[model samples]
Target: MSEKSVSTVVIDAPLAEVQAALFEIGSYPEWLSSIKKADVIERDGENRVLKAKLAIDAGMMKDRVTLDYDWSAAPAALSFTMDEADLLTQMDGTYLLKAIDADTTQVTYELTVAVSLPVPSMMITKAQKQTIDAALKELAERVA
Candidate 1:
């Protein structure tokens, strides 16, 4: 329920390519630095990841979180909510993609996080922005 931190980046890739990269959740640790490991817990009928367990270690923030993904919006958007975590009380995120051109896509990432430990609001917000920026950059690199 906390305010979400949002960031948008334009990637030099087609919408389908970007969506493909995003959908391969298990491969995230290979590109996303903060994510040390990603294990798919469940998959939908289409083989899309419906639940995943992720091990994250981003400097001051480190936790193993299990998340439930909502893929009803597919190709255009993907959203996830944390089902369980050691340190994180609430972790919810969404990725919105828009085709800018035949070879370009605009990606917007929105995240809201609340920790069990006491942390300043400003620090948490800053960390969230940094995480989003890094994720976007890595995603772009992976797709390109």
Candidate 2:
């Protein structure tokens, strides 16, 4: 485990719209550059398990993660905790949504990614944070 990175952005869209865009796993690649493919292996209400293969400029990395997503609950927060990965270990993340106004929403993304690659730990953490920030921005634009 290493230092966790958190990135937050405010989107000028309703929570429903934002949630809808986020839940559409198949459209991830359209917004997130790193996500080469995302497959929803299982789903039950607010819980989902997905297998993701991400490709950066260097190469491809794969991970299977289980996420507990809920919008029906108060405060409107979505969170996830991943199982151990073959390449990466102890990867955990959370995304929170809060109503800033009637038409604006606050989005926060938090992740703790343990990199076991040949690269430096700082490099991995920086890349992960950049990816998360970019993804959230793209999602916000879509909802807007």
Candidate 3:
């Protein structure tokens, strides 16, 4: 079965700054522990990554995943879907950013992933939370 998780964090940075850091895929390994490597396969005219390959190691699971990213301009949300992966059958996620004030922003991360191996539901949930928390914590440091 597939599992989904949603978590939010408030970063002490402007929305634009936070968005910039998030979109800097090349620098992901520096901030995101799970991402071992990231390569941009395709980009829009605006130079944003439309397709990319990611190598990740998430403790209990590891996979080389390719994803297609979509961005919304009005509300400033970036969503992605898994295009291919050896271990992952399906995966999708979104980063929704809202400006709390001039210097604070709230980031809501929603993720769903299905792995090839059968893992306990409780373990999956715990892993998801750890992944989200670590990402947000490192991101906050990067932009701060």
Which numbered prediction scores highest in TM-score against the true structure? 1
Q: Is candidate 1 or candidate 2 better by lDDT?
A: 1
Q: Which residue pairs of candidate 3 clash?
A: none
**TM per prediction:** 0.97, 0.77, 0.94
lDDT tens digits, residue span 26-139, model 3: 678888889999999998888888899999898765899999988755247888999999998777888889999999999888887778888877777777777877888888
lDDT of 1 by residue, 1-144 (tens): 357999999999999999999989999998999999999999988999999999998776799999999998877899999999999999999999999999999999999988999898788888889899999999999999
Off by over 4 Å in 2: 45-75
Per-prediction backbone clash count:
0, 0, 0
**What TM value does model 1 have?**
0.97
lDDT of 3: 0.85
**Deviation in Å, model 2, residue 101 alpha carbon:** 1.0
lDDT of each: 0.94, 0.66, 0.85
Clashing pairs in 1: none
| Tens-digit per-residue lDDT, 68-144, candidate 2 | 44434434665555544456665666778887888998888887776566767787678678767877888887887
